[model samples]
Target: MHEFTVTPYAVEGDVDYDRLLEQFGADELTDEQIADFPQPVHHLVRRGIFYAGRDVDRFTAAANCGDTVSIVTGIGPSGPMHLGHAYHFYHAKYLQEQTGAYVYIPLSDDEKRFSKELSFDEIHKHARENVRDLVAVGFDPDRTSIVVDTADADVVYPLAAEFATELTPATVEAVYGPPPNVGLGFYPAVQATHLLLPQLVHGPHPTLVPIAVDQDPHVRVCRDLAAKQRYDVEKPAALLSKFLPQLGGSGGKMSSSDDAPSILLTDDRETVREKVLRHAYSGGRSDVEEHREHGGDPSVDVAYQLLFYFFEADDTELERLAADYRSGDLLSGELKRHAADRIADFLEAHQRRRPDGPISEVVEPYRLTDGERDQLSPEVFDDV
Candidate 1:
């Protein structure tokens, strides 16, 4: 068995995702839960990319009843957004459209500064670009709220301060090793604030946070705080997903911070094609003759996995590809090209929707309203 390490800041070795659920004490998502999702379930959920969850039943139940349900999913603005980040955001958007779920996107620029070597200016620059990509996802501006840690400090910090008192140094140290800086040590509270923002603004309600399995710690930490009953908020629910395979096919999570080549959201069609053909790992035999004789393993093929993950939504098409690859009817190069073409098409549509105006103007519609700000941090707006 390969030893794996899964943490907020690092993922190493080939992860045993099932083992991770046992380690983290989260439940495997049941079929009933998946079926309960608004009709025509998301590929991520229907196909098992989002495989496990914590307190998911409550959120799904609320969504089914047409009750107010919110989803909190975020990014660390350390670099440009990539395909790995897009699926999660897009899934949230789908839920928003299907269920009228309020979406809260929090940009953790401060956390990136504390962890990475990047300057605040550089991180904020990435934040602006990240926001552009997020706005491009076509979320309802009235129902979606985008909060940046530094930019929205008036609301974020006050809530963090209150939650910080409930979080102890020992607990923080245990959950995450000793912090390299005080900023990271205090970040859990800020994270808790982000998780609870919807409830704080609109009163206690079910909130779902869809994140990769590695980010479950943040949800757990926030759940513990919410369990304290000091606040009138419900424990936030979580939907945990497997990492999108990197171009190198190392089985590690694709990340912008890593040295491996990633398909950035801004990459043009030609660049995307080149990256896949040159770097994507193949599960076919070493020689074409041998591959034709023995067939290929679509399960291990990066191209096939990409299509299975998000690009090809039709179940029948995906199954046909798998069968053909296993029966020597599909070549590795052909599969890569197919995946790249689908990806390029998705990116082209996404890029076309991207707003070209100033970041401030683009993000204005999604910012928290004065009433919400005042509700979250009354002290900041007291005299106004």
Candidate 2:
């Protein structure tokens, strides 16, 4: 073999590569980590529901490809979920109701970690709120099935091990390329079995793990093992979403843990408004005359992001306001106030719909018994 080349590029300040990675936040997944999935209707995406990445089309094509139609979706309860998480559930519920697919939802308790400074007990406790939030987002009681991994820590391991043994360590190491932790190796098995849980929970069925593309590596691992299975785990479909930015910065996914950039699922009206007005990036100028002449940056403007991601107002109404804002007539204060008021009001309405619901409450009523059966809905399947 040729000697390894140490190709040099322009050097910045003394680079402590590991320290720099720490200084700059990033995920470990590579460009190829994501799987290709079926493209669901754009409206399904806009409603903030069911998401997988490149893996979606395969699931869609398979459903039409064969006689069976069943799906699997797993949730990570490692941390309390946010509006971002709500999107996935809403979409899953929609697909289940429409298609009559056997639906499986797994709560990933084993994967949770407390704050680096906090204990596991704290993280464990937070799982309840996550369950509540998921329920409130409207997972139906009659149509869905649920499993929480903590119910029996070993419940998932047997299946996961079966998947790993079949897929082999060499195979996993080849696909994922060892790094981060030994856990990632098994994470694929855990993830694969999760998508297959509906089949495991009910019976032989087509399963799909509906999730955001950020979790794509997990799906690739799942698809690989499924292909090698005694059973088929057709490529899990991924419904993807664009990441929402922090209120104050262009980088970093929004977090439930932070107060400033975040307007949480649990935030009260005033807190919502205050967070928006105080921290939202603006589309208006620093001063009046210059702002009117040049307008502002819509890409960085927090209010605009909310309007695009969360607003329920007519598209035309939103479009008119966006045009005016870009023209410099709209002040940042005015836009922030409008967005905060609307977002707070919308969240309050959602909270009211399921007064007693929380993720745990949601998961409890929908929990599935092994060998249980439910009819699939016809709505989820498209004739085309």
Candidate 3:
């Protein structure tokens, strides 16, 4: 395929304070908190923070080893699709197109138990909405597929069951929440099943999952299951993105539920600008004059973090901003101004280039007949 340069980089203020709340056990964070989890283990992998302890070289070589590369990602229509969500998919699209990897997206209706109250039809409606949103982010229908978990014939579920049987609960808890939900207890199994779906369908033998840091637990679960698979599951790899903090807070990260901290991808440019200027966390000089003269603390500024993802430029520009802002030459307004422009540019470009329609073509579950489903070994479903 086409090769896009993948580089090591950081976005300023990409810290997700609310998400961090779960990580640090902090109830609240003042404007001063700026640190994030340890740097992602692999610098070369596109967006490394979200990945577990994977080395990029191994992934790169795997991409090389495969006759065709398959990159897997999933989404549940729990809420609207935001710019933050696009970051992960866009990176995947770039890497997939560059590496000639086929993008396999699971529409993840099966996991919609989160909105279980909704009728199957209603659940599917939102799932469809999520598909349009992803298409808007530039996925090529011909290149990408969307698989609905519920519709898959027995062929996929049996594979999924066998896959789930391999994971242990301790492994799941280690990579995710403290008091794990019973739903989450089985999360790894489902995740591994998703990763391997393509393989069962005559696609790539081993696929990779790309996600953000918060979803690291899923991959952690996969890694653990891979060890036990002697031959049972399709062990997958992943790429993780670091979380970007809210507009102004530092405690945790942008949470789907916290409207105050996020600038939704659907937000208009003017609204985006307003949020960044007024709400984006600031690391500038305490006073307007001091910040302009001394330059801003890029570390503390949410705008910088967002720009790291939106700017599409090298680090030198950020350093320049740092120098100017510290000297009182670059104002918070200037940072917001640039951030707004880049964000606006990104959104518009994405809208203009959004994919034509539903990724259903790419994600259609591997259909199986009743006979095939019945043929599945009962042993595969043994509760782990």
Instruction: Give the alpha carbon lDDT tens digit for every residue of 199-252 in model 1.
Output: 998888999999999999899999999999678999999999999998778778
Candidate 3 TM-score, true structure as reference: 0.73
lDDT of 3 by residue, 52-72 (tens): 324333445655565555677
Reference-based lDDT, each prediction: 0.92, 0.58, 0.58
lDDT for model 1, please. Answer: 0.92
What TM-score does model 1 achieve against the real structure?
0.98
Query: Largest TM-score belongs to which candidate?
Result: 1
User: 199, model 2: CA deviation in Å?
Assistant: 3.4
Candidate 1, residue 334: the lDDT equals 92
- Root-mean-square deviation of candidate 3: 9.4
Which ten residues in a row are the worst by lDDT in model 3?
Answer: 29-38
- lDDT at residue 7 of model 1 (Cα atoms): 89
In Å, residue 155's CA in model 2 sits off its true spot by 3.6
Order the candidates by TM-score, highest first. 1, 2, 3
